[model samples]
Target: MNQTQLNRMKDGLGFIAALDQSGGSSPKALARYGIKEDSWKDEDEMFDLMHAMRTRMIKSPSFNADRILAAILFEQTMDRTIDGLYTADYLWEKEGIVPILKVDKGLAPLEDGVQLMKPIPDLQKTLDHAKERHIFGTKMRSVIKEANPEGIKKIVDQQFEIGKQIAAAGLVPILEPEVDIRIPDKEKAEELLLKDIEENLKKLPADTKLMFKLSIPTKPGFYSELMKDPHIVRVVALSGGYSREEANQMLSQNSGLIASFSRALSEGLNVAQSEEEFDQTLADSIESIYQASIK
Candidate 1:
């Protein structure tokens, strides 16, 4: 479908995650922590050990890209410090990949919880720096935590001011609100969430595009129903631990993107794990959706 004709939505149904990546830095032994001079020049062994130790963390595939990408807007200084934001920043540029960053309503600027965030230039600067680094996506997770409509409006408004420039760089601003777009028997959830969307999504630039991300196995026609809401441009069905076969079967039934945490399936990476399951999940997902994408 053409860009204008395509639903502004580009999010695949849901995100596939195994654990919280932000809990802490990659573990290091105090021996290696060397207070400025161990010259553990057996550096080769230390490197091997470090690789073996943290293999579990980076093996997930999606973890590193996702974390570094979040620096686009959130205050991820610690992450930047540990990973060298600029180095990590430059890698995604060559890949043409813009990873999605989900945020609950609490992290939003328009709410009471945001009282300590001043002028909020931190997020904008981060995003701008990412743009300079050559990133393409500025994605955020959305949620409705406030009963006040004005508060939601404020949140989206601030997000727009911060993210609009990123879009100018051909980087899309994805507002990934974590809610069930379709509630079969329970219409109230959809109603309430849509209400929040309507109030908060006002006054957007004409060039701005918004897409919603939702988990699957919701009510049967839940996806189509969610599409009925004008705010959502497109919908992506996410698979949580659903195997390649199952997820492909699901994506075959739809017409949107098939996203997978394929990077996590270290099997394909052939790193620490034995060759069990390759990163075929990502391939299968993209193939299934592409096939169905054809009339």
Candidate 2:
């Protein structure tokens, strides 16, 4: 483990950039970037285009450690390079931003009002590859759509079970059991989710520290206690389908929680923009997110 990276992750003042959109979400992501589905004839081409978009963001002047603490990458992106250096290496060595890999194989069908991550076969193999690529941590996600105790419990349990494995591999894990922001009982779901997380935190070893990527709570400061837990490294909020403005507004109301946004982070960016235009747009987005995070 790189102690310097770990210390930076523990004390970083900026937000995480979720550049981990995978197979299922890539088309939508590209569409928002002004690339249509017809632009690529096959999966390989699709991924190439996606990688290009990521490369552009990574190469941007505003996408460094100054206002971005870390970046969560898709496995394929980790395997690729930016400016001749491996993506994770470029992020850490060149940009000073910690790199985390998204390790989940996407969500399973919604069940019991939640969607747990599908089983990850040979997960250790993936973790090994991430380490070799200079990744500092890993992130996996699950979703909660309703306030069902049984469902939310399952989500947290699966997250921690996998999180422990990530820790044993000498990598920090950002456990994300995101509560759907638009659910009718969103606050109730958050309450139940908090209780389950607290219970799980008690079961971890004393030295095991974890991070969380969650939805911005309906009640401001709802996660204050969780953020203070010794076992918690940081608590970051996902945009969870909210627009950038809305997500930032909700995030600023929470004192310690910071952003780990994907769509919100890439919101004004487009493939057709000139280099200067793209950089300025990205800079504005990062600035807004950074301010919201620090508040």
Candidate 3:
């Protein structure tokens, strides 16, 4: 979490394929990609498929980390050994890709239908382990399903609190507070979201190092303040269910918010394609997303 690493985290397109999806999420995501659940009889089968997808992306002949600055990984994937190297180190050594670990234990329902991350099992211990493995950063997620001020504040507060702990351990924290795209009044919600976050941030000591992984703003430039904030190392946008084309369009219009996309990045990749075709599809996706990030 030194300046060099912080600069890299802020520098290029981020791929977030780290999905330790719950039972419900797995099937729905598979279905979205036209994968049939019956093809996988058990959770282990599904996980094998998930791991394959991410590893394919990493090892693809067309894989380029020049624009793919970092990759966030599921904890299980972090431990995976490929070619005698831990996956994190493998990515770093082979592609110059900094690997980040997904540390949250998924979400639990909160009051007013909001959600917060379930308690991470031994969070400090996990951070220590990640640092030892040379993982560059950590990411945790919470949701803002509505525009309620209270809910937004709660998300920001909790993220900053946990983020401080991660930063103290010398790992950068990617604080993701995703605002669900289904809601109307998204522009108003963005304004309130930034306002609340900014107010809370002011109370922290001036040196709190953090980063953001937010939903694409409803309006262009909604996150201008964040981009200008010195305490923030970077501001990245989540695709949040947008199609690849739509996410790229919105991302291009915004200044300073680079993509840390998960589903959108995986949208066109197919396990069934010929190797040449698959590489071309992946190359095209990475180049397009990379272009948007530089803009």
Q: Which predicted model would earn the best TM-score?
A: 2
- Pick the winner on TM-score between candidates 1 and 3: 3
Worst 10 residues of 1 by lDDT: 18-27
TM-score of each: 0.48, 0.99, 0.92
lDDT of 3 by residue, 116-185 (tens): 7788879999998898888888998998777787777888888888988898898888898888888886
TM-score-superior candidate, 2 or 3: 2
Per-residue alpha-carbon lDDT of candidate 1 for residues 136-237, written as tens digits (9 for 90 to 100): 444554443433345444544555555455455555555544432232433444444445555555655565655544444333444565554454455444
> Which residue ranges in model 3 land beyond 4 Å of their true spot?
12-24, 29-35
Please give the TM-score that candidate 3 achieves against the real structure. Answer: 0.92
Residue 190 alpha-carbon offset, candidate 2, angstroms: 0.6
lDDT: which candidate is best? 2
Task: Please give the TM-score that candidate 2 achieves against the real structure.
Answer: 0.99
- In candidate 3, which residue pairs clash? none
**lDDT for position 50 in model 2:** 93
lDDT of 2 at 253: 97
How many Å off is the CA of 106 in candidate 1?
A: 7.7
**Which residues of candidate 2, in runs, are more than 4 Å off?**
none
Local distance difference test scores for all models:
0.39, 0.94, 0.78
lDDT of 2 by residue, 173-236 (tens): 9999999888899999999999999999999999897899999999999999888899888999
RMSD (Cα, Å) of candidate 1? 9.4
